[model samples]
Target chain A: MPRLTARERREGYQREYAFQQRHGKPFFPHVVFHDTIVSLIVVALIMGLSVLWYVQFGAIPTDPMAERTGGLLGPAYEAKADPGVLGYHPQPDWYFFFLFELLRIFKTPQLLIVGTIIIPTIWMVLLIGWPFIDRNPDRRLSRRPIALAIGVMVPIVLLTLTFYGSKVPAEGGAASTEPGAAAFAAGACSTCHVLANAGTAGNVGPVLDEAKPDYATALALITNGQGAMPSFKATYTEDEISCLAGYVATWSAAVGTTPGPGAATAKDYPASCEKAGGLFAGTVSSASGP
Target chain B: MSTLLPPPKEIAMMPVDWVEERSGAISFGKFMLFRNVPKDISWLQTLGSALITVFILQATTGIILAMYYQPTPDTAWMTIQWITNEATLGWLVRGMHKWGSSVMVVLLFLHMGRTFLFGAYKYPREMTWITGAIIFILVMGMSFTGYLLVFDERAYWATIVGVNINGTAPILGPALSYVLMVGPEIGTNTLSRFYSLHMLVLPSAIGGLIFLHMLLVVRLGVTSPPWSRMEPTEGDV
Candidate 1:
């Protein structure tokens, strides 16, 4: 596209303005009515889908009391101890999934600022500064290949990242072999304690590898709790607690090497954990012992 | 010039008539509403108007939501829950506001695209485009900050990530992050700061900027299609 000279651009704007003065429509009813109709349609669509889809609001807000009577959002949202996919790993809304995926892709701590901040900030600046930089007078998209390419690539990259991010687990580890993994997932320990075997990367508490508590210590902590880690005794059965403590003790020691226990045995605990139970139920052999 | 008002039958008449006579409100309204927009400006140009419409809808619904939403860390989520589940027609309003934001963002981008494609921001209208850019950033800011007001785990984590992203800027990154987050972390203070920005600062800035944008639109007149070289002759309609 040939750049317009200053005089040519000025004259062009003047001629356009003069033409508009002679033939332009009024803003009152014509433009106003057109905009209103379109906006009304949009509003109607929003309300219609809201009623039809009926989005599920998760558990109530996490509060101080939530610790005692389960979490504020309830146990439903808690990380599944059983584990096929750890669904309770907190993710941003869908719009932010692209960034979330970006964070995942740039996994190194050094690159955190680049993925999370620098790149996005640069994009925003470029977007706001686009008109200033691009002075081409051509009005057609075909003539502006560079601009068009950037526009198309942006959304495509975002969507691709978002799609990948949505399904990808936050942490890495082999599938849980021990039934204690089920108990761990069921008890919501995965939310706070990072355990590789269980595929949990919670940072709120000490990493299980670093603080490899024995069966007795795990059991004590699970029953009584300490610091920010609330006691799960009220929420779990003693059998379930034993399973979780044993699972953590074993897996915490064997951080990376082998997935301990070839498979789990099916022993019905009183508490039914849909998430954790689903994970262990399939993997269980008939060998039942801690 | 002859006076347009007809002789009134009664001296004390409608209140509107009294105001119109004293303040020339009718004339001002005419001047404001009857402004010309280029006939050649296609449906693409209407995106700006559509964006404004959705923005108004967002502001209205947001005002209603603010009536019930408590901006505390503890009660914020519970209040949102109440508003969503129990409040009369609250779900509809909240949904509209949410959807309206998406629509508004889409329209803003489309509108900016149209202006750029037509080269409307070339010379005299640069300020208009600049103000528009600022407004776009403000709108996105409002949306991001508003997302956290939901106080859900998703919202909380989103805010944490968002604030941290602010901290990723170069020299002023940490300070900017601190100011926005109201300390070094995302907490109740950060929530309140976001709430104030969403409800007050950004909206007010947008409102004033939009006024400037519209004034420029009215003053400079909407640009005709880039290809429209046909001029108005003496007998042209």
Candidate 2:
């Protein structure tokens, strides 16, 4: 942008270049060694935190039977009303929530390409092609209005989506109060299977209301895991399980009719469950701690 | 007199000096390790070096983790649980690897921002920036593939969703999704494919491209800020 003769420009550049050459430090022991030290410190910090605090993993993969039983109950229940009564709420990691929220908002099958594929691909292309697109040699932020605006806007939008994605819906029906419902909730049987009496909306497993298995079939499946459902034989005793199977069978048989002795209390829980404390500790307050 | 017996110092250095005599390895090391950059370059410029460091951490810890990890629907979650909860200080190694990934991503974004902010991608440094951009994409691919190695419910469902998103890509979408899924559905084959990509393919590609990027950086030298006193003259160009 500045007018100058070839001779003056050459002379001016030579003087500046020599000045720069004399002022810089070597990369090896200077910058490289400093970087290495910083990296080591970071690693040390991570290791220290890991030792001091345990990284808790979520409960073992969802037990499909839970959905049929009424969905997750007791302390583990996330009380969020799923958009549909049968669809499992699929939550992606926090980092991917923006995209997940995007998919949720644009729910039409026809727009899947636009929401899931086209938009992300365009962003990736823009990121990769940025150096070429903004070729101005000026390094000042004020000189690059368009690039600066995009850099700020992208993160703002992503953060807003992530915040909204994390919020659970508060509209799911209230927790059931029946004895059979208590067992279903206590055992976390409502998370994967759909049961009308239990009021659980999960669809990871077969709908118990539709399948309408007999008491014998229900007992057998409860004792031995089927499909994605884990065997509860080890977690619950014969008396507790028998009661549960009968309760589930009664509800399944009366799916469209008045619900069977529809409510349960701590006294109704088997003595074996009494020893377990957390799920069947007699008192309703302690049975499902927040 | 010295022709009869060389000094003790010379004798002590004989092995290294002998190797250097034929190979010029010492000089090459000196050239690489002692390269100069402008003094005004601050900690902001260290992001690239930080990325390289975190990458080294990821590769090291990842290899260690892979030794005990099982890539299967039934075993992957259990094995990862074993590593974090039971294996001796496995938490430290796994935690470092996990945190290292976050650090690498952050450092990469910072490095790219710095390069752009300083206009380092202009002129002779264009190839350096291009190579860097390629490496950036490769690193992201590596991260995404590595995410599925845990094989927990989250991992399984995430892959399902991710693959479907890939499938929504117009004409090539279905084909790419099929290739990634290793079939119409995700199963053992899909895990193995992602494992191979995470453990072998992407790392090798990234390593090669980073080497090329470093080569270009060495050729043109790191660029300066717009306000820096020094500028390349016509003769220097």
Highest lDDT: give the candidate number.
Answer: 1
| Residues B1-237 of candidate 2: C-alpha lDDT, one tens digit per residue | 878998999899999898999999998889878877766666667677667777777889989999998887566666776676579977678767766776676677778877876777755567788888888878878777877786654465556667767777778977987899897655678888999999899998998888888888776666666666554444442
- Clashes (N, CA, C under 3 Å) per candidate: 3, 19
All models, DockQ values? 0.35, 0.29
lDDT by residue (tens digit), candidate 1, B1-237: 236664565445577678899999977888778977766555566777777777778889999999998988777876766666578987677767766776677677678767766667766678888889989888878878888887665566556556666666678876887798887545678889999999999999999999999889888987777666665545557
Please list the residue runs of candidate 2 whose C-alpha ends up more than 4 Å from where it truly belongs after superposition.
A1-19, A52-88, A165-290, B1-3, B231-237
Question: What lDDT score is found at residue A191 in candidate 1?
Answer: 54
Q: Which ten residues in a row have the lowest lDDT in candidate 1 chain A?
A: A75-84
| Tens digits of per-residue lDDT for model 2, A140-216 | 66776776787678767877987766654322244354345555653446654567666665443456666666667
TM-score of chain B of each: 0.89, 0.92
Best by TM-score: 1
Clashes of 2: 19
- CAPRI quality of model 1: acceptable
